[model samples]
Target: MITLDHNTAQRIVDRAMQVIGHSVNVMTPDGVIIASGDPLRVGELHHGARHVALRGESLAVDASNAEQFTGVRHGVNVPITVGQHIVAVVGISGEPAKVLQFADLVKVTAELMLEQTALLELGQHRRRQTEDTLLALINGRAVPQSWLDRIGFDLAQPRLALIIEPAQLPGPDDFVILLMRQLELSDKSLLLAQVAPQRLLVLAPIKPASTTALRSMTEQALSLLQSSLSANVHMAVVIAAGQYIEGSLQGCYESALATMASGRRESPHSSVHCYSDDPVTILWESLRPSWQQQELLRPLQTLRAHPRHLLYVRTLQAFFDANGDVKQCAAVLHLHRNTVRYRLKGVEQLTGLSPFRLPELLHLYLALKSDDLSTKQ
Candidate 1:
């Protein structure tokens, strides 16, 4: 049962007055005048409205019988009902015969507006509940089994979580609808919700199929999203490795976040990234901070203070990437072999580690990689 409060009742009264050209009063089921064209009567009780609400019918109060009832007026009062329940009463003030014609019309309008408001509120409430459930799942919060059961979500099933970070924010409903349609998810197997202002999280059930089939489906989905959303959105997908269950979501979310971070660093041109595509970089990123204070990185940190020091690091990276071949490193850097050698010597002098020695070369390479990761962080 829905009850009419003062705010909604006042809106109904104002709107009814616009259409009917008569003073209107909106009353609660208990006959308290919550809203009225006559502001003085707003907090008063109306006997005629109470009679109509209790009897579940329209009641006409004429001037002849107006003095018999408390707060009675010369008007027609009709019950405002939602389904079979009388939620409120609406009265049109004037001669009974003149106002009777507008009483039913105004009552219907108010009831319809209240019904629409109630439905909108109910939808918002459900959306909030859905977001709460998804947040709990992604964050690894413990929820009661009965609560999941009540919501009709099964946690034991295998599902892959994907995080979508859009460049421009879209409404949750539009985002969900467009994503579901583009991904060809037409049933309950897909759960998509906006967990933040610019981020949407999705959990899709993994069908019983080979790994190749799942990869194909994921590729197709990414293609569709990229094409549908244009170039304005970047998506990161992380597939669960082990048996897909409720407990694996946190790891998957972390993997997805790491994948996105790595993608933005390594492959900014590509709009999508998968966890399996670059596991080494992601794992190394998790361990990079611990190596921040390593002695090998100290030299690079010191070199970074020099204005033109990045040139030495790039030359060293190219040298290592070319496997210590001077000609190949020079070709990769598009610099003369002599120039590459001079930069390598500069790197050795600044870092106290020669690029030619195997042990020193390994140390410089690791240091360069750690420096890159730190800059990104």
Candidate 2:
């Protein structure tokens, strides 16, 4: 559209003025000065610039010809041509002959700067598109072939998903770059996106190599990220790596998400979680069949319907999270040891599953985790 914003115009003038040693003016196609080394000249009309821009040529003014235009100076005004368009005009202010020598130089400088700006804008746009495509793929949406091809996404290739949740950090765009740099520092490929404001998703390829190797590499890169963030930024992060999958990415993404969610629910102190840490629980939370989910929740039905359902559930969760330690659970819940034991007994009587027995404890734990995921969903 040939819309030269004031900031970009000022930057072009600043860059060109450094070399020309004279005031430089950047004017829009209609001859209104958008920027100039002499601030007072900004927003003033430059007749010579308008003529040069309209004619697609250069105009020189001198003492003899200076009176031809109002508020015109003795300098050369040339069109800043970008591709086939004359987006703006550059006027170097000095003696006509002296400034004439810098006419093409200033013009070329402005055009190069404009081109660089365009390239940067294009790159940012493409990066946004890539992120959108990655998000759609993770969400199991059918992406267009063109979009997949644009970002070089291959559904048939195995890739593990890594979900990153950071607190008190910079905006997603900046953090994504930081993550990219950190991964690059470890000499790993970058295929990541900011799927949410506080979350990032990285797709790590597991080609001919083993998932274990890729996981190790990811762990090292994230460790570096943790150190970097802790040293430079006031931020804390939790990262989860999902299992490797090919042909589809939804399961992998869900696995990473579930890993993070389950980790935070079960062990909030942990900063890093991998799918292998508790694949059974993670998978059960995400992929359990409706029938299976109903069956699992059946044990908790009576307890959920009880008058003190929330208390019972909270105590049971605290106990399981404490690894079946009544004292630890009591401490965590700020309850007495007997109160904790009493609550466990209440949960067992209501749910028909004993929290004290190992086998029954497993069932109760799974049921609790399943209920948690279901409620969140």
Candidate 3:
């Protein structure tokens, strides 16, 4: 009867703790808090004392001993022993001396309720944990197995794994779970689990009716995500495209990892890149020799002349960039008021590049752009 007896452990802790002071707490042997007087601390993690755990004894401390410890609450962590085994612990906080007085009585009362509660909890947890293990092992239980409904794995439809490396995802644990829930209603369900810290394993069902349609939807969803979350991610999508078989999961997983490994590092110049069956991988294999690059601007030789002539040419280009405002270019380049006019006149005479002519202006623009790009490369 005693082994099967039921009790309100929280109220017992509440009543017993009321005799003491400030805030009191009771914790299981494993540190999961069972009950407390403080509303905020109830059902929270108990990490106050290590001695009560190891030696099953009481420990007292003053706040002056700790630099960052909060207040002047006296602490007593009394171990609740059941037949030489410590089942739980009652930790009291209040006026230092009074908590020590009720320590022995609280231990006996709290441990009684805690022992029974702990057993019931252990049994329930064991049952649920066993169910979880069974669900994990069973492949087809993704659909619905009455005994193994703990996990939402869609068994009827084979699943393909997708690794999402978003543009800027530091860790998308909750977001990935939300995405899976969003896909829960269809014939094929999605389950997102973290395979690695950055690699999220998405189990997408491959129902016959959902193939093409789902693929389209997935691409659209990813595109939207790209606009939203692409800042943290830089990996390409590598799908194991064929039939989803259990034997193929390893291959599929390997395929996804290989694809991620092959993903390029972020370049300061490019925002993002998507990989497909692109042959451009081998297109730019060889680097051009510097001597060959130097041969690219051969026609610019006509423009490179006397130092003073080059000066007039640079001044004329600056004037164009200032929207043909010679006075603005004059002030910026710090030339005499007439000196800017003289440079433009000299530029028109020497290179024959007219500022007013659209065609000549186009040529000058191309020359400048080509030189800038080539110079940077």
User: Model 1 over residues 181-265: C-alpha lDDT tens digits?
Assistant: 4443334445666665555666656544465555554554444344444333234322222122235777666666666667667
lDDT of each: 0.72, 0.78, 0.52
Predicted candidate 3, C-alpha RMSD: 17.3
- Candidates in order, TM-scores: namely 0.70, 0.68, 0.30
Please give me the total number of clashing residue pairs in predicted model 3: 12
Ranking by lDDT: 2, 1, 3
Clashing pairs in 1: none
**Quick one: best lDDT, which candidate?**
2
Sort all candidates by TM-score, best to worst: 1, 2, 3
**Prediction 1 TM-score vs. true:** 0.70
Q: What TM value does model 3 have?
A: 0.30
